[model samples]
Target: MTEAVHLATARVGDLAAVMRVMDAAFDPLFGEAWSGAQLLTLFALPSARVCLAWHGEEPCGFSAARIAGPESELLLLAVDPAWRGRGIGRLLLDDWQAWASAHGADDYFLEMRADNDAAHLYSRAGFVEVGRRAAYYRGNDGQMRDAITMRQRPSPKSGD
Candidate 1:
């Protein structure tokens, strides 16, 4: 049996580890790679928030979001290949929602590849499909795919 993973808000020092998880999670689906410098820029962004999942001090998963105006957008969420299906992703999502609500956000949103398997996770997390964009991503295999937009409204009292 596998042990439960631990989740926590990432500190500044965890940037590299978070970037590794992001790169691993997005590379296959997006094909557009994020360089270390770009990751650094993301980490440094004032509106960005990141949460990490750890299994004995090693980062096994992570989630990132940015708050702008009245909404928060989930930028990324990735779990280690070996740790997939263990609920770490859900934990990160839950954490992100709670944190965003606390920070005065009333709505949460995200965009994912229409064909990405992880769409189920967002759906289960209470995000409803609101729209889609055709030919949204050009995969490494030279194929175009649609992008799905999902959104969730926070509990009225929770955002106060």
Candidate 2:
């Protein structure tokens, strides 16, 4: 967080950088990280969008999402552990929300494991609990965890 981190809209060519961030951010113990092939397929979709957070040429964080009609879903949000608590994740989320808003999306939706500490981050950003699925996640430790769904709706802008 020493240097200013900026966000950029990612294209298919930037998949490598995206994966690099994802691999570093997501712990190997969880075994939940996405593969390059899967990311490529997602990037090929019409509504797919990714916002990358960079710190002096290094990919520190990123958010992957899609916009469909009036609602948008945040498929993934990850920040390197070293960059955590430095506001990089929040910046990436802000960029994602702006991107979705520009695409005619008013309702923002996201789901995450109940045990994830990042829930506080989303909650501070105006997200409210909408639903939950029991035992929705199976960790590598063989424990079943619940999933929490959250929603955020930004008030409409004047003339928007």
Which candidate has the top score in TM-score?
2
The residue-by-residue lDDT of candidate 1 on 51-76, one tens digit each, is 88988877899888889877999987
| TM-score: model 1 vs. ground truth | 0.87
Candidate 2: Cα lDDT at 5 = 91
For candidate 2, write residues 1-160 as lDDT tens digits.
6358988888888998999888888876556688988888777888988888888798889999999998999999999888888998889888888888899988999998887888999999999999999998888888888999999976877999
* Model 1, position 78: C-alpha lDDT score: 86
Quote model 2's TM-score: 0.91
Can you give the TM-score per candidate against the true fold?
A: 0.87, 0.91
Residue pairs in collision within model 2: none
The Cα RMSD of model 1 versus the native structure comes to 2.8
* Each prediction's whole-model lDDT (CA): 0.82, 0.87
lDDT of 2: 0.87
Q: For candidate 2, give the lDDT of residue 59.
A: 82
